[model samples]
Structures are given as C-alpha cells and as structure tokens.
Target: MLNLKQIVAGYGPAQVLHGVSLDVPRGRVSALLGANGAGKTTLMRVLAGLVRPQSGSVEHEGREITALPAPRRVGLGIAMSPEGRMVFPTLTVEENLQLGAIHARARRGYRERREEMYALFPRLAERRRQTAGSMSGGEQQMLAIARALMARPDVLLLDEPTLGLAPVMVKQIFEVVQRLKEGGLTMFIAEQNVRQTLEIADHAYVLENGRVQLEGSGAALINDAGVRRAYLGM
Candidate 1:
C-alpha cells in the first residue's frame, strides 16, 4: 500500500538515507530492522512526511506524497507513533487520544473510536483521566499506540515501539501488533527487537548504513544463517 523508491534524505549536509527503497503491502506488517544509526527512523520520518527527501518518491496506493507535509500526510491516512513515544506528558490519557483525531476525517465517529481505543487498551480505559506523564513506561507505550490508532490511519508507522519496555511488556505490545495485523491494519514498523519483530511481521527488511541489505519473508529471515548469527545470536 506504501512504496518508497530510491529515497535519499538527511539533516542539512549530512545525508543519512542512501537510495533506500521498500514496499509495505496493504493489510500486512512490514518490519524494518537495523541497528542504531542504520537510518530506520529516518525512513519512517520520510514516510510520515516529517523529513523531506532530497530525492526519490513516497507513494501511497498509487499517488506521490513526497512533497506533502506532516499534517497533510496524517489527513491522507498516515499516522506515526514516534521513537520516543512522545506523548503529551501533562495531558490526560483521553486528552492525548483526542488530539490524534484532530483531522477532519478522523473526527467522524471520534467518540466511537475513543471507545474502541479504551477497549483495545483496558489500562488506558481505567486511567483515562490520569496524566500521561504519571503512567508507567508500558502504559505509556500502550497510550502511544492507542493514540495513533485513534486517527484511523490506513497505514501506521511505528518507530521503536518496544524500545525500553520490560520483556513482559514487549510481549504485550507485540500481541497488540498481532491483533492489529489480524484486524487488517497496514503497518510499517521500524524495530530493533529482531526475533519478536520477525515473528509478527509478514515481510522484513534489514537495513545497514542507510541501505537495504536484506529483504525476505519474515519466517525465512528468522531461519537465515546470516540473520541468525547477526541479529538472533544463534
């Protein structure tokens, strides 16, 4: 559903992505795997229209969106939960979620979507009035993802969604990812949790030095000799 072709992006003169290209199929989870500074997050930023690529194009469905701004991208069915779970700390959980539906399209049935989010994350339901800053790390992560889904995005961009959560919390978050996949939500996840990411992703790509070094079905990557040695430590 989303296609990025020969993308070259960076900060000022320091280029980070060097001709990166990938596809995210509709209703499937596509994992972008890489070590730190591999440009995974940069690619996500490009797709979300937060970073303008110097060259190459971002196409959703069949139209180019490379020139679109961040807010326009959100209106066009793209939403991102950034790397740090940048939730508004001072805002209540419900208020944070409400902000996600600010786009006119998402505003339709906003109340219903809020209820759905509460159902998806029962903890948030219980703490709807609690300040986001007061929530635990795991709860915060849930709130982050829940907030993104409130926009009813056609494709969700998740950058390091499980970054620093405990093992149990990581498992819980992945379960939610699985549930979203089952619900036919198209997602592009940039993650470092190799094993868990591959287990849940339909397809996966490994990035090295801002380039795609490997691409394959997630199960195949799981059993790949190189992937096992490098990522799985097997």
Candidate 2:
C-alpha cells in the first residue's frame, strides 16, 4: 500500500499540484481521471520520486519515502511505466528489459522476472531481439509495461498506457491491466480514457486544477451524473 498526503509539487516556481492527497491500497487499482493539465501526471511523478513534493509525505506500506530519489523508489519496489510508452527505441526488447533490472534489488531473480514478463506479453518474447523502435505502438506499450515488470515491483504506476493507440490496442492494454489486477498487482494509473479506466479501477479520484475534485468507488463514478457529463459525455 502507498499513501500520498497533502502533496504539493510543481516545476520550478509555478506550482502544479496543490495539497493533493490520495491512497493506493494493496492489490487494488487506483485511478486518477482528468483532462490534460489536471495534474494527473504530476501526481504520478511525485509518487515515482521523479518530482519531489514541496510539502507532504509519500509512504509505502508505512515507510515514508518522500525524499527518496527515483532509483531509490525503484529499489523500494515501485516501478513506473511512463506515458507515451517511452521504451528505449534503439535497444532490443531484451536489452531494454535488462536495464530495468539493473538495480541490485531487481537483479537477483532477473531471469525469472524476465520470463514472467515474456509470459505476460508473448509478443515481447517473439520480439526479444528486435529493436523497440520498429514495433507498433501497441507492441511498444506492451514492451513498456513488460519492461517495468522486469523490476519485480510491488506497486506499479502507469501513466497514460493507452494515450494514442487504436481502439483494439486500447482494449488489449485494458485486458493486460485486468490480468495484472487479478494477479494482485497494486497499480496507480493516470488516464484520460474515463469509461474504460473506471470499469477496471477499484477506486478513483477525479482531479481538477491540481486537486481532487471528486473521489469514490469506480463503479459509483461510472454511474455518477457529473462524471458521465464531464468525462464520458453520456
């Protein structure tokens, strides 16, 4: 489980997140839903230790990690599959995954973890020696998620996993998420794709202007009149 309390973060002087607070329960999917510029990515970055909060705390299973660096967070069993599927374009799929396990904490069972990733996304196994740049967007997204899993993280942060893909690919990505959920992976996701995201999320927070505008169970949000009107356009 991870807890972020009153997180205040921003780039340089202009603040982006304003006292944002949320929780990611163990073995459950927590979603952050909002339009662009709603501070969703910023919040994820803070949790990943890429962006340190100006004020507040980040606790992983009751261990405060607010000041830890990104690599330290990875060592602490937190992994992030960034938005836009930022795979190493020039590296082979295997090579990219290898880098993910470079940290000492993830190195011990590297082979086993790699194999698990392959099993989760067989396309990755087929393209083990292929350059990442040559893969399709959907394949690249899968590669990104697989690469993160190589670290054997306890909590996974996914930022816009379905950003710019075909509808079919989106469904595949969601399926992967469902599978991860069933496997008891603690995931915190930031997404613009509301309907599908809420369907899979156990709990969700709706963000607006660097703050939580609403927070509730995903199923409840699905039937929420305001959520339907604003994000789903129902």
Candidate 3:
C-alpha cells in the first residue's frame, strides 16, 4: 500500500537515509527495526509528510504523494504516532482524541469513532474527561495511540510504541496492534522490541546506517544470524 524509494532525508545538512527503499503491502504489518540513529524515525517522518525527503518518492496506493503537505497525507489515511507519544498535555483525553479528527472524512465519523476509541481502549474511556498530563506514562501512551486511531487511518505509522512502558503496558499495546492487524489495517511499525514485533509482523525490514540491510518475512528475519546478533542481542 506504501512504497518508498531512494528516500534521502535528514535534519539540516546531514542526510540520514541514502537510497533507502522499502514496501508495505496492504493488510499486513511491516516491521521496521533498527537501533537508535538508524533512520527508522526519519523514514516514518518522511512518510508522514512532517519531514520532506531531500530526494525520493513516496507513493500510496499507486498515487504520488511525496510533495503533498502533512495535512493532505493525513487526509489520505496516513497517521503517525510519533516516538515521544506526543499528546496535548493540558487537554482532556477526549480533547486530545478530538484533535485527531481533523481529517474531513474522519470528522464525519467523529462520534462513532470516539465511541470506537473508547471501546478499543477502555482505560482511556475511564479517564476521557481527565487531563492527558495527569495520566501515567503507560496511560499516556495508550492515549497517544488512541488519538491516532481517531484519525481512522488506512496505514498507521507507529514509532516506538513500547518505548518506556512497563512490560504489562507494552503487552497491552502490542495486543492492540495485533487486533488492528487482524482487522486488516496496514501498518508500518518502528519498534525496538524485536521479539514481539517479529512475532506479530508479516514482513520485516532491518535498517542500519540509514538503509535497509535486511528485508524478509518476519519469522525468517527473526531466526537469521545477522538479525539475532544485531537486534536481539542474543
């Protein structure tokens, strides 16, 4: 559903991705794994239209969207839950989620989506009226993902979904991802949690030094010596 070719992008004079290429097919979870500074997040940013690529093309469903603005990308059903779980701290959980409904199509389904979000995340429902900053780290993470879901994206880019959460919360987030995958939502997941990512992913790409070094079935990459040595620390 998404194709990125020769994506050269970075912050101010330092190009991080050099000739990077990857494909994310429809109805599958594609895992992008890399240690820090591997251009994983940069790739997601480029896809989200937050950071324009220095030179490359990003196509969605065979339509060229590389030059489109970020809001247009969101309108095209692409949403990214960034690395830091960036939710509006002072806003109530409902308010934060409401912010994600900026897409014209999404706004039409706002009430239904809000209830769906509450159902998908009961914890958020319990504190829907509470301020986001008051929630625990895990709850905040949940709120972040929930808000992203409020956009009802076709291809959700999830970056570091399990970053600093406890094991239990990580498990919960992964479970939600698995459910989304089962529901046939195409996703590009950037995760440091290798074992779990491989377990749930259909295909995987290992990024290193700003390029994809290995791309294969998740199970295949999981058992590969290179991936095991570099990522799993096994």
- Strongest candidate by TM-score: 1
Per-candidate count of clashing residue pairs (backbone under 3 Å) = 0, 0, 0
Candidate 2 structure quality by residue, lDDT tens digits, 163-190: 9999999998999999999999999999
| Candidate 3 Cα errors over 4 Å, as ranges | none
List lDDT for all candidates, in order: 0.94, 0.94, 0.92
In model 3, the worst 10-residue window by lDDT is 100-109
Evaluated at residue 125, the lDDT of candidate 1 is 99
Q: What is the lDDT of residue 99 in candidate 2?
A: 93
Per-residue lDDT for 1-234 in model 3, tens only?
A: 899989899989998999898998999999999989999999999999998998989999999888999888888889989999999999999999999897786898798999998999999999999999999988988888888888889999999999999999999999999999989999999999999999999999999999889999999998999888888998
Could you give me the TM-score of model 1 versus the true structure? 0.99
User: Best to worst by lDDT, what's the order?
Assistant: 1, 2, 3
RMSD, each candidate, Å? 0.7, 0.8, 0.8
